[model samples]
Target: MQHSKLLYEKGILHNKKMLTQSQYSNFKFVARLDQIKTFTAGIKALLFAEHGAFMINEDGFTCTVEQGKCIQASLFMMPACFSEFYVDGVVHFNVNMNVLNECLSIFAGIDCTMKMLYKGPEAPLILVLEPQDECEISTECSIKTTAQEEPMEYSLDDNSSSLNVIFIRGPDLSNIFQEFDKSTEELEITISPRRPHFKIDTLGVMQSESSIEVAKSSDMILMFNCRETTKARYKSSLVRMTQKALSVASKVAIKTDLSGLMEMHFMLQDDSQAEVYIQFFITPLAEMD
Candidate 1:
């Protein structure tokens, strides 16, 4: 597996034109997929926003969406997800998520091969779909693209800051979230090295409070590393944005820094064992007196 890095730097665009003329003769990026369901699943998870930045590199493809400037979600599809993937250097563009989703799902319940092509930053993304069972059926779609915007910076330095990390099975975490009160306005998370190692508290709109505590010895907890007791409050709506990804993930690793930034990595694996990942970064809500 290739190591993937975030290519969100503005300076990287300067290198786009340096590609050889031969590369320009062909599309800057081209990818083929035979398993459309797996690809659509990841895309649907990041559809929280209307438009998103689409990035492709030698490693794979990534789509990122941000909401309220405090919450950001990214979906990564590795090269293994595509039958054929090629990129000159790195390509970044913006596209409408709803349009792309609809195009990909046009032939529902049918096995189809999808081919995607992008000539350059200014060119529209072209998708060609052909039913495998019926050679006569084919569809082509052209979705307009726009310049990429600077990605939001929401990173946590795990080594320098006092951090707490927890690994949990996806289904277990999903079940826990399902129990949260839907009318809650705030979700408070507390982690400690002592008893009731992990806890969640919610304050409803009516000011009613609910709390849940999990023991460190619980079977659902795969690993727990707590440097110190830490507690933070986050917007309930923002935290609930992860439900789609959580429903499909097999495992999840959550990390929180002293600054109250929360990061979660949700891992999804298909029947073929190919892995897809969805990540979320959330900023804590300000406290009141």
Candidate 2:
């Protein structure tokens, strides 16, 4: 009994020592004026899922959300977007995006400045926001973090077929997505270097089948790299998710691998005068028997 009591005391001391050491550890981050807003809007696009995981390193940060294991969305902000960034190594944690977003937006129209801090994996995300205004209000929030789960890795590079490409300006795609037949279960995407470079087919309400085709030489086709025909079908819901990223993107590239995984790369400009990318991946619907 005495030995057991001594062991317990030793464990308590060790924990206290560890806690003290962590308190002195430096993990600090600060974003420039417009970066906070841009980051906020970027992550908001992933609210389709309930939770999000953030991985932070010297390169900056990546926020990811997975849906029903069928789709994965990721937003990356490079180190250039931050005014100051310091971290020992990669830090990974999960959080409720809905709650964290709300907290981040608490201060509005006040020239808000933001800082994030984390001592270690076990610590909560510390946000210090201050608004430079006559009122001079500041807000602090501690968002609890959870263990990071291994994210699904899509082996898009392993596909054997040549890459099929479709380049469309964001505004054009946004307008096209708006016309998508939401009533349809899936959106069929067909691409070839032939006359009709791109084609989208869907069944509208009342079982009406409709298809929109874009000519290869059309002005909307910024770049086309498909030499072989590639036809794949994706869930309308998953395709629609890209609309959020498209809203802020200057342009987007819709590419498909041989295995039929679609990757949407969005080109978003940051206030730091550099471009940032947000990528979304959707698995193609299996062919119906």
Candidate 3:
């Protein structure tokens, strides 16, 4: 929020006498009571104090006239900053020095406490008198910037191709039995990197590795986990389980032909008294010479 227009609307352009002429424009802020604060409504006003950039709440509500670095600001070229009150009204604001002391007390147990501390616990501004020819008004201060830690980001390669992965959480023996017990799913188990190309089920070929946590079932949040020994990274095709009992074991003769093999058998494992879980990838092939 450039300070000029705020002054324009508030009928207070006369306050410009205090700004130190600089290339940077001062901030213009407007706010009203919470109930009356809106896009077009609010007790709007302009303040051109040297101690601009205030913070509000304990990092809750911040105003443009006195907000912090992380406080949301509008795009630089967007004509105005988003720092204005989302709703307007006469919400009271603390003075800069008081805000500093409050911030220090609240952040005492937080990380980066010292980094936020002001030199001698003073606010980042100086209260002073610029010589007025005949009279001196005493309501302004001067401010500057300080170093702080970087904000967080969760950026990933936007260009990476996404694969459709599935998961079977632990051991759903019912799903294991579904193969023979008359349950069916639109299922594509595993594809052969080597041909004859087809999905060959070694279902019920449970290993202790099938247990996993998938935040979303849409197959997007899950990514390739690196294999312990082979170090191969691939997204899980499934993340489900049947039961926790490992004693219940079942071996099934599946009707699918493995690549270059006439037969494929699937072994199912189970927990105490629960259902079973099936697991197997296509039989990896050796490269042709």
lDDT of 2 by residue, 166-285 (tens): 787888888887887668877888887785678988855576777889887877768877857878888888888877788998888888865778888888877786557788999988
Estimate the Cα RMSD of every predicted model relative to the unseen true structure: 7.7, 8.2, 22.4
TM-score of each: 0.87, 0.85, 0.19
Model 1 lDDT tens row, 191-223: 889977999999999999999898889999989
TM-score of 2: 0.85
The lDDT of each candidate is 0.82, 0.74, 0.24
Best by TM-score: 1
Displacement of residue 89 (Cα, Å) in model 1 is: 0.6
Query: Candidate 3, TM-score vs. the true structure?
Result: 0.19
Judging by lDDT against the true structure, name the best candidate.
1
